[model samples]
Target: MRPVNATDRTPADLLRSALATDPARPLVTFYDDATGERVELSVATFANWVAKTANLIQNELAAEPGERVALLLPAHWQTAVWLLACSSAGVVADIAGDPSAADHVVAGPGRFEDGLACSGERIALSLAPLGRRFPQPPAGYADYAVEVPSQGDLFRPYAPVDPEAAALIVAGAELTGAEVVDRSRADAPGLDLTGPGSRLLSGLPYDTWDGLSAGLYAPLAAGGSVVLCRNLDRLGEDALAKRIESERVTATAR
Candidate 1:
């Protein structure tokens, strides 16, 4: 089989390459101090979640290419899965954006009511410690845990995704799928994120380019892994340093 060229690949394609290169390597580690939660995912495991979530978007929600999906959640591992799922399904991920303008909305419990108000279909995620199903699902929304499990483990988009089509809207800028890939490729080396395994610890919000780069794109582009921290402000300096030491974080993005 011919090897795929990196320049020709999308951000989603980079994830597949990461899985192929080292399926057992940790792709993401997440911590939420307020919730006292910690979770880690290997490349293969992360890719599986992405596939299942993509199936939910494609099969159940009937999300078409170029559709907009509003992501109303925090810096959780599942949020990473949703981001990749949107890319794989060719849907634009609107991170913490106005849900009213979306074709579909995925929200955590804190944003569930607002998500329901949107005219589009909704997927509610508990974002519970282990990504558990909601105790009581909202009347009209699909519970991510309940529905995503039965979906196919493999995903193929119903139509070809145009790399030039808008794929992300964040921090008041919109980027096409190809632009995201190009930018990540160009910026990764400069960010000290190049990897055959770099480990990055990031305390950035997902709503901005810097945060997205540190938390998602950079690591994927460089074949590195990320330790994404939420409620980082709540952690004392000593605790933070200990986390870095234990996780073997090679770089810090604040």
Candidate 2:
């Protein structure tokens, strides 16, 4: 339910934009994918979570601005929050995953033929399980942890985000530049997913146009959140319900 307008804003713009005018609305509903239980996150609560998560990424994870980050996560609620927090804090979420192809296959934009490449800045991250003990941070990371209680909304503002600055780093070379905000739209519905308030439940990865845009970007663009479950055990309905119930997500693309 979006009006036709020039949407140059990244998925991050959504929650803040909504918070600017509507902070008390029911912005998220965590539904148990299996049992169908629900927990709604008010606008203020969602904003708080985003700020806290963003702080963890920026301060603890040392996610510098404009850096390309690779998110290797299965479809669930946490993935959505990670994406939105990154967007709000100006961290590029260059999501990567395998579609319905072989385990060795991955998503690609085939832009290497366009004559562009990485500028020697690349990071790969795996959002490990909070269910188990923390795993080692990927290469180049300074420290790592599986979970941290809310960093809270008591953090500082991040560096100014250059709208066109690279907000992503996927298979496409130099994924996105500071001058390419206008072109973030994939010219495909699947690529223009949504922002917070929406729900995208899947046990798959966020690599395909549908998964990335609809699942990650769409909800955030709409001032909503994303939920990425491990999708382990193929994600039964009970697990999905738990995420939705905990997050209080409303709409969903998947």
Candidate 3:
């Protein structure tokens, strides 16, 4: 693995580099057994989503660097977009914390009621098969599908973010943007993510370090891609193996 100057670059920077290298390579493939949903995004497509999401965060929500954005989501593809959006906007992602304390909250259908308790701005995602617009949006919350499409495909933060700013608060641990980048670079080799073509099958939940590494950080750091599975516990061993074979997954973090 190459040494990264974490003090100079954030996770979003790494993703941009990856996009430059191979825009057509698959960056994320998501699976939801319960919903029979499967979505694949190339680097360019994923980056487009990230840009729109970041624009939403910066322009609509007016979230600033170091602000906390609570993410009440599963290991779905849209969840990954939100993660990168927060990083790109220099907002701290809170995956396992009190939503009410966050400056902004993004919630899925099941967590909509709990998200309403948050005093900050809220965005609700239906997590529909095609990421469809919420049929009946909550009274006060913005619907992600309704707003994100109108945002710009390119994103530029209002101000440059400090690498030392807090970027994530997950599972009782706070990590700066620099720390997150450094750890992702360091963890990639150990995770057997050596190059761009490497594909990782991750069954881990996003709230844990292992999950974040496999699902987002490690892949981006190594210029690789991820196959993220939600409700993976429902898959039988045979089914799992078939998926690994079909997706051509080279590594797994479960």
Candidate 4:
């Protein structure tokens, strides 16, 4: 392997950076609107969460490095933690709305129908009823949301990971068939998630690329915190500005 250098960046680099500077800082938080669940991670906990999650994925899901593990999830705390875990393991997470038929689908019961519909296998991270509950959880799927915890979890001791590589595939400014016909294609941008003072106010729908990438991956990649709201519109002009001020978020890209 080439000697690690500044140019040879990876997702693990971001985690390490956060660890060095402010390991106890708040990196990300996910709030569940339905269950009122709040999941929070500090820089150190964020790092560990990713490691354990990655280890589990590698061991159980056979998520080889660079293999795209797709997430069909709403903006839940578990989903946020999984994003961090995927990046740490160097597994490419599929956030594309147009998932191929063969992709492994992981989703919550009620909110992730599209994810479940598209996935070959399903995993539930929580025990809460997902509206029209399935007679039984999908055969190949496992309930992981409730199984994994932030501390003393089975995978929590996973070793630290490298930072430079395809931590996750980030999508930006994508247009649909009609929208593409009408608009231009910009090389989708990667928000420097691990950049300083990164915090998220995810006001977008989970299924949308911008929502998932910008709202989710951006924060996880940089070891930053995710600020979730039931609806983006809830982050109105004043509320958004106030939240930013309160959080002291830096380098917002929007």
Candidate 5:
């Protein structure tokens, strides 16, 4: 596996490096025990999602560089996509942030009322199986599932992304794109992610910096993959053990 380079100052850079090394390698494997749903994304597939979503953020939402998008979704696969999309688009992703203060907002079905507070563009994610659209589209909100499919497979930012610009707001601390990458790389060792094929199974939410690092950034920076589990506590101990064995998880972050 190729190590993250000094030129890789942002999360998007890390992703690009991974895609270059092994496009077919699994990057993220998501599980929702409550729904009995599982979705796997390879490096290429995940990059495709990031590209389309970034296009949505730029072309549809009209979000400019440095603008902030309040992310009101849970620790799901789409939320991970949005995080990378925000980076690729040069916008900031505020996890579980106040919608009223954002330039745009992305919310799940349960947060529609809160999403309505954003005066700018609003995107709603159904988070249903197969990333389905809402049966009834919420008024004033663009359905992400419907809009993303038509976006181009490639993405180019309208403006250059400054590594110094704020890229994420997690746990009340703002981090620049460079800083996020730096911290993620620094945390890899602590998480026991020691190079290629290191697999970490994480049940942590995305609300905090720690969770974000464990669930996505650390494994990514270490040239490894992640098994992200939502509603993880609902699974019985025996079931969880079986899952760990089946997924070949090397470590766990709870």
Candidate 6:
């Protein structure tokens, strides 16, 4: 089996490559039009978040390789962090997945009740600006914002992640880590993410493969970045145009 490394065998590898190439470059710029909120994460900062979250998954949750983690979250930046964290920890992330069968569950405020169905460790994300913790912690659920801060800044999976092992389940398809990387590389050119400083503006949700590819994977595979927009339909054309220009977006997937 191929090893997961920075040269590109998995999504974690893509993130590592980005961090190595330009740690200061903004990797993910997120906007919540409804709340008029914006946040930007550089490659280094993003990697730190991934590392800490991966530590939380591997140590606190004790989630081993091949364990399924139900991600009941949306297209927020924290959600993206969790996606890569799962890769780093050698766990399978099931997007909008069934919680009951998962080894662990990461849920947003809206999906808190649903995550209760899971028998394993449960984590909740407030998804608030600056990753603020919940005002009051939910019963039986660890608050991600609170717990992640205490985790290690670096992560190394207890068990090596097999590039050929299952990594993601999305939109009715299961993809191994290697396959996800391969597909992302293939999708980059078509998504117009092969150019220098390619920045994609994506208003798509995270439920489907297309959304994940355009919003996160494709840009990472191409050594580019993304501007993730939530409630984008609520933004007027004028506002959207200004955002495109201000964000230096070269591609769009809505």
Candidate with best TM-score: 5
Which numbered prediction scores highest in lDDT against the true structure?
A: 5
lDDT of 6 by residue, 161-235 (tens): 899999999987999999999998888888888644999999999999999999899888888899999999999
Determine which window of 10 residues in candidate 3 has minimal summed lDDT: 1-10
lDDT, candidate 1, 1-254, per-residue tens: 12335544566888878877889999999999898899999999999999999999998999899889999988789999999999999999999878888899999877887887678889999888898887899877888999999988898988877888998999779999888877877767776876666888999999888888889888888888999999999999999999999999989998
Q: Which residue pairs in candidate 5 have backbone atoms (N, alpha carbon, C) closer than 3 angstroms, thus clashing? A: none
Model 1 segments more than 4 A misplaced = 1-4
Alpha-carbon RMSD, each predicted model: 2.4, 8.6, 1.5, 7.8, 0.9, 2.8
TM-score of each: 0.95, 0.56, 0.96, 0.63, 0.98, 0.96
Candidate 3, residue 75: lDDT: 80
Model 3 / residue 36 / CA error / Å: 1.2
Q: Tens digit of lDDT per residue, candidate 3, span 51-128?
A: 999999999999989899999988889988998899999999999568879888999878888887789899999999
Which lDDT value does model 1 have at 194? 60
In candidate 6 the C-alpha lDDT for residue 8 amounts to: 80
For candidate 6, the TM-score is 0.96
How accurate locally is residue 3 in candidate 4, as Cα lDDT from 0 to 100? 19
lDDT-best of 3 and 4: 3
- Angstrom error of the Cα, residue 3, model 6: value is 19
Computed on alpha carbons, the lDDT of every model, listed in order, comes to: 0.87, 0.49, 0.88, 0.53, 0.93, 0.91
How well does candidate 4 score on lDDT at residue 179? 27
Better structure of 2 and 4 per lDDT: 4
Scanning candidate 4 in windows of ten residues, the lowest lDDT window is: 180-189
lDDT digits (tens) for residues 210-235 of candidate 4: 66555554564444556665534534
Descending-TM-score candidate ranking: 5, 6, 3, 1, 4, 2
